[model samples]
Target: MTSEKRESALGALQSNLKKGHVYRREDLLISSNAVDRHLKQLLKSGVLEKLSQGLYYAPKTSIFGRLPPKEDDLVRAFLKDEEFLILSPNTYNSLGLGTTQLHNKTSVYNHKRHGVFKMGNRSFEFRIKPRFPKKLDKEFLLVDLLNNLNSLPENKDVILANIKKMLTNFDLIKLEKYVLLYGVVRTKKTVLSLLHDLR
Candidate 1:
């Protein structure tokens, strides 16, 4: 690959960036045939490391040798679909959820079902759930926030504070709507109980 082509590819990669470690060929360019060939050459030269077929990451050299590619590189490559959002293991762990319990390699909850794809060595999983009404953003946010808070480190005070913050910022009507939508009566009671305790 010529320096100019290589530079252009790198520039593209740096721009249009997303969270996590992986990227897709389509993401790199509108047309990736030439870009893929050049990227492969870069891989052969040790300029980059191929995580899996069609997935690559810039490798960092250590005094001992080359370090392994970051896990996010593989994740970014696997999670190319715009419809599904990728959640890191930390995020999952924070949510107090376990990958083993999920029984899928790559699991994401969405409103619509989609087929899985393999990128590099990892497998991606998608989950389709019922969709909510358009006016329930606050409610959905609170539900999501509660779910994630459960996964966070155990700190009662912190959790209470966050819940209060969420309640303060959220619309009460939306909260009621979300409670009805998710059937989270116990969660609503818990929030109310916590607020009472705070008082």
Candidate 2:
């Protein structure tokens, strides 16, 4: 009788969740008594993939087999909120500032959860910041690059020189605004000195 109920509950759950969509354990609306058993059954059957504790997703299979869940989906489920920004030091490589080293970690800027979080076999360094841009932009990236300069494994003076040269091509007004809004004390000071040189 309990097995029958679990089977019925699993069927209802499978029908409700669309493929490739991540669902938190709390997202289930069924009675809580057998929810754990139902999830275990589903996992054993390969109908769902357990991403982490309390997080599951209906597998999206392809010719290559099952695909991993999207990073945004994992983050949304983990944070239980959509307000966050994802970035990586690798972004700095595109700026042509001579930063050739590759980094494995990603940074998640948000108001909540300040610590490292593991998502789908990847590490995300969550930083609690007072302010962050809704979307990444070149000017903002420049400011962030300087903000994390000391952390990067690179020659700082060379990178700073390259950035100083590049700033002349950027919109001074917008760059200044980004500096004020998101730049750390060290970053702001450096940008201000560069802007003064530009004048």
Candidate 3:
């Protein structure tokens, strides 16, 4: 492709791209004179941001500066699947379970990928689990807190005691359901033990 044709192709490709929308390499092929060349130039010129192996994003900018891609969008593109759930440790603080430590990382539970991945400035800790809720609820949160208690920075013994007291605040059926469904063996024992103590 000649330089003029390349520029025209690039411009055409650019026109089709919407800021903050992500694209895959194959998705851009039909619109490019030379896909690789166009991608290289676009990256060099800061027009496109590489997300993962084949993912590229047209970033959105604001007065503060360039904006990071939305978490759901980033994870969806990275996993190439929409079946995923994002949970932040910061959210657990709302449970009033004495989980006050701040956490910067977000956990992604999905069937496709397992391990940490960095996209732009954020790091996602991907965990492969057989089951996860489509949306978060307090019942699920409490169960999850027990499931991951060992990894948390707070005092586990006190947190477990706190969890025991907060049981009445949640739906028992749902809470027990999540514990049976999502809890590890240790978590199951802990929750069961707590319930036994209550009785």
Expressed as tens digits, the lDDT of each residue in 1-199 for candidate 3 is 5778778889998889889987888889888858998899899999999987788999899999888788888888777788999998888899998999999989999998889988877889999999999999998888888788888999988887788888789887787788899999998898778776766
Greater TM-score among 2 and 3 belongs to 2
* Alpha carbon lDDT at 82, candidate 3: 88
Please give the range of 10 consecutive residues that has the lowest summed lDDT in model 2: 28-37
Instruction: List runs of model 3 lying over 4 Å from the truth.
Output: 193-199
**Sort by lDDT, top down from the best:** 3, 2, 1
lDDT of 1 by residue, 37-130 (tens): 6566656765655555667666556788756555444543455433444443333333332222332354455555566755445556655545
Clashes of each: 11, 0, 0
Model 2 ranges off by over 4 Å: 1-5, 30-33
* Candidate number with the higher TM-score (1 or 3): 3
Residue 186 C-alpha lDDT in model 3: 92
**What does candidate 2's lDDT look like per residue over 106-182, in tens digits?**
99998889988765677889998888988887888889999989998999999988987787877889999999999
Clashing pairs in 3: none
User: Relative to the unseen true structure, what is the Cα RMSD of model 3?
Assistant: 1.8
Question: Considering summed lDDT, which 10 consecutive residues are worst modelled in model 3?
Answer: 190-199
TM-score: which candidate is best?
2
